[model samples]
Target: MPDIERKFKCSSVPYPPIISCIALLISMRAITWIGFIIWLVIRLIIYFIYGRKHSIVQNESKD
Candidate 1:
């Protein structure tokens, strides 16, 4: 009988794209903050609307 070993590999982005992404973030500082705030508001609204309805505590209280 022979023993065999399996290996897993992962891929990563090259340095060029990584540098471009950092540059973009630095260039769009104001827009980035605005977008972040908008995203947070939307997420909070969703959590209050649909998330709370489907929560375990709410379900338990219903019974």
Candidate 2:
């Protein structure tokens, strides 16, 4: 898999156009901005819930 990925740059090549299409779709209102807002809120909530517990900096500070 690493050899194939290196030979083709498969990991990086496919993502940019997919991201661009999604961005364009969102800008054109095909996907709805409200859904994006909700997605962001959920991401923030999950990060607040889980990120602090696993943070290396916070654990190191405690020591």
Candidate 3:
């Protein structure tokens, strides 16, 4: 049978590990921000095109 010793025995916070984790978190945040900006630009472009087309169609129908 495997011994189920205390899990906290080796739970020491090391500098490199902490720094790596912080860097990883920062990178993840940056990636998310970039994706959000890209998505926003795409949505705006699509909406603008749709709006222009809609107005043109409406004007044609009125004439």
Q: Count the backbone clashes (under 3 Å) in each candidate.
A: 0, 0, 0
lDDT of 2: 0.82
Question: What lDDT would candidate 1 get against the real structure?
Answer: 0.84
lDDT of 3 by residue, 1-63 (tens): 467776665556587799998887777877797998999999999999899878977779988
RMSD of 3: 12.3
Pitting candidate 1 against candidate 2, the one with the higher lDDT is 1
Task: For residues 1-62, write the lDDT of model 2, one tens digit per residue.
Answer: 54454544456878899999988876777356778889999999999979899899999999
Mark the 10 consecutive residues where model 3 has the least summed lDDT.
4-13
Which residue pairs clash in candidate 3? Answer: none
What is the per-residue lDDT of model 1 for residues 3-33, given as tens digits with 9 covering 90 to 100? 5664753456487788998888888878778
Q: Assess each prediction's global lDDT (C-alpha) against the native.
A: 0.84, 0.82, 0.84
What candidate 2 gets wrong by more than 4 Å, as runs, is 1-27
Candidate 3, residue 13: Cα displacement in angstroms equals 39
Candidate 1 residue-wise lDDT at 59: 95
Q: Which ranges of candidate 1 are over 4 A from the true structure?
A: 1-14, 29-32
